[model samples]
Target: MPLCSGYMAPEYAMDGLFSTKSDVFSFGVLVLEIVSGKKNRGFYNSDHELNLLGYAWKLWREGKGTELLDKSMGDVCSVHEVLRCLHVGLLCVQERGEDRPTMTSVVLMLSSESASLPQPKLPGFCMGWNPNETDSSSSKHDESFTVNQVTVTMLNAR
Candidate 1:
């Protein structure tokens, strides 16, 4: 199976499990990226080394969720709607698969303005990885391969 580490849920990354909830988690990442106009992978913040999700979570907790909106939008969208979408995005990226909302629930949450949203827990895969940990793996091996013309790079447990 083909995999991109950025969108993989913690359970799938660590345990090789995939399910609807995993899809939901990916969707959540997509939503945050869309709102912030940033990629979840390789996202950089000067103040912290957090990924896009962690940065979004931090902004949301600090009551600065509006700061996450793509500035180029220039008031073209409703602030309420944008924040609502961000809230739903956070809900979908909760650390535990079971804590994530189903796609059905996601649709309803996005469409309903009056409905209340629950607080989001810590998101999965939000921490930065160590750059110098080559010897951490028990096995000593080096291999290279490619899929669909894309070269396989480093592999790490996120």
Candidate 2:
């Protein structure tokens, strides 16, 4: 799938540099989005301007991470499993690419219940649109981006 530039790692977003770690960062964002059933972009909270990552981080830090789960999936999933996924997702979106786990590590972390995962620092692009800014018409600090569509297909081996 072709993701918007919003999912790009901070280094790649700012410096046009990308690597495997960038992919890790994107994966982390995906994981968080999935767990929350929310898109990283176009997500708005009445309480604050926090995007999905910021909101998730806040909840996790406040010992209310379970509230981040999508209510539609109520009673259909394991709280422990969901929290684990949330943790793994946060780890993947760490501000520094090097802080993110490799794909191999991600797989293991997701699959192992006993794995000791490290706490994630603030994620890249955690801030959302700040409505308090008076310069809405100015594009100088605009984070607005155009979406590009790309289709991906995977063939299964029998």
Candidate 3:
């Protein structure tokens, strides 16, 4: 979606630079979608590319974020609780990593009703690719190293 929208921010998108905040942003979007039963990437409106995140932000600023709640939830949902979750999600997606809350803080916020929340900054790339293939490459490297070690051990024994 980043590539398609041309909205990929240079810091987080092209450089493969990401931090916990990046995960936070993703988590925010995920939570929003879960609550609203909407998809962020595929959302469409005649006037804007405003995905679920944008739409939620708009509603939030307008004091109508509660309106974005999934109609299906009906009376089961708490308006204040939902708003708090949405606020925390937005804080997670702040454009600058430093501005985002750590997972620890997020958990605290979620669990503690009295916790003070920080104001959220504008969110980073609304969409992008995952560049962390290190886990896959590390496994391949480990296999190669094991093979090399076996070859050396055999030669020494001979």
Best by lDDT: 1
* Candidate ranking (TM-score, best to worst): 2, 1, 3
lDDT of 3 at 7: 29
- Identify the candidate with maximal TM-score: 2
Give lDDT tens digits, candidate 2, residues 35-145.
889988867566656788888888989999999999999999999999999999999888888888899999999999998999889888777664454554555655566
What is the RMSD of candidate 1? 9.5
Q: List pairs with backbone clashes in candidate 1.
A: none
lDDT of each: 0.85, 0.84, 0.68
Itemize residue pairs with steric clashes in candidate 2. Answer: none
lDDT of 2 at 2: 16
List the lowest-lDDT window of 10 residues for candidate 2: 130-139
Q: Candidate 1 overall Cα lDDT vs. reference?
A: 0.85
Cα lDDT of model 3 by residue, 120-150, tens digit? 7666654333322244656666453434434
Per-residue lDDT over 22-90 for candidate 1, one digit per residue giving the tens place of the 0 to 100 score: 999999999999999998876756654577888889999999999999999988999999999999999
Q: Is candidate 1 or candidate 2 better by TM-score?
A: 2
Candidate 3 or 1, higher TM-score: 1
lDDT score of residue 127 within candidate 1: 67
